[model samples]
Target chain A: MQHEREHTLKAFDQDLDRLRALISEMGGLAEHAIGEAMRCLVERDVAGARRIVQDDKKLDALEIETERRVVQLIALRAPMAGDLRDSVAALKISGVVERIGDYAKNIARRVPELQDVGHLEPLSLLPEMARIATHMVHDVLDAFVNRDAEAAVKVAERDQALDDFYDSIFRTLLTFMMEKPNNISHATQLLFVAKNLERVGDHATNIAEMVYYAATGGQMTERLEKAGAL
Target chain B: MQHEREHTLKAFDQDLDRLRALISEMGGLAEHAIGEAMRCLVERDVAGARRIVQDDKKLDALEIETERRVVQLIALRAPMAGDLRDSVAALKISGVVERIGDYAKNIARRVPELQDVGHLEPLSLLPEMARIATHMVHDVLDAFVNRDAEAAVKVAERDQALDDFYDSIFRTLLTFMMEKPNNISHATQLLFVAKNLERVGDHATNIAEMVYYAATGGQMTERLEKAGAL
Candidate 1:
């Protein structure tokens, strides 16, 4: 009976490792999707943008697969306490990562439309904002993997910088639109791209909150409020 | 042993039912938030808009409570197959509903900005679009409660109409911005309001997908694609 219990415990560990590996894989794909989408945007590479759009399907498939694995692990292993939180957090974060991928694809779709328009001053901010957003995605997933609540809190704090970037971009784009009617369409598309990046930052923050809760079993309400205040 | 098993099962059912009730409560709050935000926008009721913003905190608190209950239920009960799906679906839907409430608050935040702009042509569509989106939230939550996959699919299909309304509003607002430079700022705010309503529709559709999966254990990829094609 002792040996049998040990074997079952080992199998449970393997199941959890597998779930973590799957989420890490999904995270890598989502991060690449965001990078490629931004590259396509800055380089004016329409084909590259199309590729990111196509690649989003892989992230979608991975999300479904991750959800399946989570359900299977719960049913077979019946994880408790911390294990249960880890499994549920993985499930929730997969959805958020998939959403970040969608935003990347949405940004890519706007690339072709912007190709004909002359470069505007606010376009310079796109790469920086995208960089910050992608970095947040990376660091937050790392925090999840490491079970580091402090790292996750730091990631949540970074979102404020992204928010500031968005405000600046919004003001700049509005000026561009107001200056000339012809700039309206391009400016509006850029506005959406900025908004998408802001949303990606928000998703990253969401993941950070989940990671904190998964690691500590304590709500991050006060911490998040503090971050927001900052 | 058999008696113990039956008691445990009964408790599991009660837990699931409790989670469902919490979700329904949250959904009602979100739907009301959207409606009140729209009413505030149409009536130029800054106080009403402020109320919607304040009410969003309740949705946020409910989401945190829902997540905690979901984690506790999974840890204690270790539900399998259908029960597991129901719990996770409740978890996912709570996040979506919370986001919908946030969007309503975002729309409300713009009301004061719009109050100074006087009436605009595209502003008329905001209430109608909001109505459709809120109705989708109501129906999708109903579908969740009933385990009605067909009704969820129907709700998903309705998103196309919201998309259409958004497109019409987008074009009209763009025209208004182009026709008069002074209209740019207010029209832009209206554009964002329309975008928020459209996003609420998207969140409602996402809930419908989760409901369909929870009910049928089958993906709604084809149905979603069909809706998008329309």
Candidate 2:
């Protein structure tokens, strides 16, 4: 009986490790997609943007695989307490990551539209904004893997910078549009790209909250309130 | 043992009923918020917009409650197969509905921004767009409660109309902005409002997919492909 118990425990651990690996793979793809989409925007590389859109399918597949693994883990292992919560978090985070990938895809789709407007001033701010948003995705997934509630909180805090960047870009683009009405359509695309990046930041923070909850078994309502105050 | 099995089944059904009720409440709040936000936009009712923002917290609270109940249902019942899938679907749908509520709040936030440009021509189309989106939310939640996969599919199909509405508004607003640079600032707000409505449609479709999956235990990839073709 003792040996049997040990064997089951080892299998459950392996299953969890696989789940985390799938999530990490999905996160890496989403992060890469963001960078590539922004790069494509800057360089007017429509082919690369197309590739990013195609690559989103892989992330989608991984999210579905993650859900399958999570379901199997719960049914087979019946993980208790923190483990169970972690499994649930994994499920939710995979969905969020997939949406992050969609945002990247959305940004990619706009690349061809901005071929002429690539030199716009607000365009320059976007790569940096994308960099920050991508980092949040990276850091939050790391927190999830390590079950580090503190790191998760830190990641959640970084969203403010992204929000500030979005606000600045919004103002900059509005001015650009007002000054040059001909640029309205393309500038509008950039506005959405900025909004998409802002939403990516928000989604990362959401995953951070889930990670914190899974690790600490407490609601992050206070942290959210604090962040709101910021 | 049979009596105990029957008792367990009864409790599980009651738990599911509660889960469905919570989701319905969240859905209703989200749908109502969409309508009110659009009304506030047309009427220039900043106070009503603020009220929509404040009321979003209640939806958020309900989502958290739904999550808690789902966790309990999973842990205590240890549901198998379809029941387990339903529990997981409820978890995901709650998150999606919460986001739908956030989109409504986002629309409301812009209500104050558009105070000066309330009479814009494109503004007329928005209330109808919002109406359709709200109906989608209402119908999809009904599908979830009834486990009606066909109804869910119908709800998903309606998203195309929302997309069409968005496209027309996008063109109209671009022309309006180019004709009057002063309108760019407010026109941009309307663009985002249209985008928000489009996303609400997408989210309602997302919930419909979840409902379909929970009911049929099949992926919606084929339907997605068909929709993409559309």
Candidate 3:
């Protein structure tokens, strides 16, 4: 009987591991989409941008699969307490990651529209901003895999830099638009791209909060209070 | 034993009803927030906008409560099949509804910024668009409560009109921006407000899809194909 119980436990662990693997897979695809979208933006690669948009469908499909797995895991295992909470968190994270992919797709869709605009100063800030946002996506998923709450908090902190970049970029674009009225069309597109990256940063922070909660089984704000980080 | 089983079934039904009630409350708050935000925008009611931002906290709190109730229901009931799927869908719909509230808060945040600029033509189109988006939220939640898949599909169909409003408003704002450089700043804010309303419509459609799936025990696309609506 003990051996049978041990086998059941092992199977449950395997199910959980599979769920985490799926989340990591989705995260990898979303991160790659962001980087590739940024590249397409700077290089004016319309075809590459279009491909990124197409690739978002994979992320969408993965999210559905993740949800299916989560429901099946709950129904079959009937996980109690922490295991159940983790499963639910995985479900929510998949949705957030899918949204991150959408933001990347949004950025990509603008590439064709932005092709006519000559190189602008604000464009230089975007790649670095994308890098930060992409890394937050990367590090947050790693935190989920390792169940590291501290690492998740650190990832949330990085959003401040992305926010600052967005503020600076917004001001620069506004000035640029006022200086040359003709720049309004293309400049508007760039503004949206910047906003999308900022939103990606926000979504990454949101995921970090979910990860922290899943790992510690407590609200992230409580963790912050204890660490005097709030 | 039969009596006991009946009692258990009734208790589960009550739990499900309570869950539905929480969702309805959240949906109402989100729908009202959208309308109030639009009113604040058009009237330049900075104080009202601030109140709307502050009120979003209640929606956030309600979502947390809904998640807690969901976890408890699943852990205690160990619901199988459709019951489990419906519970899961309820959890997701709460998240989506909370996001809709956030979009309203976003629109509210811009109210103060727009107070300085004179009224633009696009502003006139926004209230009607918001009304449609707000109604979608209300009708979709009603569909959830009623388990009416057909009603949910009707809500999804309304999104095209919102999309059309957005496109028209976009062109109008772009033309305005190009015509007068001074209009760029305020026009940009209006553009984001329009985009926010459009996003509310998208999220409402997303909830409609979820409601349709939960009600019909099938994906929305399948239902659409069957009805020749696709």
Candidate 4:
């Protein structure tokens, strides 16, 4: 009986390890999608943008598979407490990562429209913001894999910098649109691209919160709020 | 032994019912929050907007409780297959609904910022778009409660109209900002407001997809895409 129990436990551990690996793989794909989408914008690579849009389907499929594994693990193992939280967190994080991929795809879709418009000053900020957002996605997923609450807390703190970048870009875009009425069309699209990056940052923060909860079984909001106040 | 099994089944049913009730309650609160936020924006009710921001905490608390209940139920019951899907769906839906509440709060927070700027033409459409988005939220939750895949599919279809409204408003705001450079600041804020409403519509669609999946044990993306193509 003890040997049988050990076998089941080993299987459960493998199931969890597999789930984490799936999330890491999905995260890598999402990060690549964001990078490629931004590259499409920077290099004016319409074909590359289209490819990112097409690639989002793979992330979607992975999310479905990850969710299936989560449900199966929960049902088969009946994980309690921290273990259950880990499974649920993986499920939620996969959904968030898929959304980040969608945002990347959305950004990519805007590239073809912007091709005809002349470059504006604020256009330069897009890639920088995308870089920061992608980095957050990377670090937060790593935190999840490591079960590092401190790293997750640090990731949450970094969102403010992204917000600041967005604010500066918003001001610059407004000035550009105000100076040249014709700049309004492309400027607004850039505004959306910036907003999408900002949202990616927010999703990263959400994942951090989930990771914090999974690690400590305690709410992260209070600590985040206190950190914000500081 | 049979009697014990029956008792366990009864408890599981009650637990699921309780989860549904909590979700319904949270959904109602979120709907109220959205309405109040829109009302604040339309009426320039700063106090009311402040109230919506504060009230978002309630939704947050409910989400935590719902998650805890879900973890407990999963651990205790080891629900398999369809039953596990139901629990997971509830879990995912709670997070989505909470986010809808956050978007409402975000809109409300913008009200104070908009107070110093004069109204633009597109500002008039904000409340109308919000109404549609909130209605989608309501109907989607109802679909979940009733296990109505048809209703969920219908809710998903309605998001297109919301997207249309947003596109029209976006163009109008761009025109207003271009016609007078001074209109840029207020117009940009209105643009954000409209985008937030559009996102609420998206969240509603997310819920509809989850509800449809829970009801049919099949993905809704293909159907949604076909509908989009039509």
Better of 1 and 2 by lDDT: 2
Reference contacts preserved by each model? 0.59, 0.62, 0.59, 0.83
- How high is the CA lDDT of each candidate model? 0.88, 0.90, 0.90, 0.89
* Segments in model 3 whose C-alpha atoms lie over 4 Å from true places: A225-229, B225-230
lDDT for each residue of candidate 1 in A1-230, tens digit (9 for 90 to 100): 99998898898878877877888888898888888888888778999999999999999999989987887777667777888888889988998999999999999999998887676778888988998999999999999989999999989889989999999999888888888779898889889899999999999999999999999988777766776753
Name the candidate, 1 or 3, with the larger TM-score value: 3
Worst 10 residues of 3 chain A by lDDT: A72-81
The pairs that clash in candidate 3 are: none
Kindly report which residue stretches of model 2 are placed more than 4 angstroms away from their true locations once superposed: A1-8, A116-118, A221-230, B116-118, B223-230
The ten-residue window of minimal lDDT in model 4 chain A covers A221-230
The deviation in Å at residue A194 for candidate 2 is: 0.6
Instruction: Return whichever of 1 and 3 wins on DockQ.
Output: 3
Model 1 lDDT at residue B82:
80
lDDT of 1 at A169: 93
Arranged by lDDT, best first: 2, 3, 4, 1
C-alpha RMSD values across all candidates: 2.7, 2.3, 1.8, 2.1
Determine which window of 10 residues in candidate 3 chain B has minimal summed lDDT: B74-83
Candidate 2 chain B lDDT trough over 10 residues, lowest sum: B221-230
TM-score of each candidate structure, all chains considered together: 0.91, 0.94, 0.95, 0.95
Worst 10 residues of 2 chain A by lDDT: A221-230
lDDT of 2 by residue, B70-154 (tens): 8778767889878987998898899999999999899999978887664688789889999989999999999999999889989
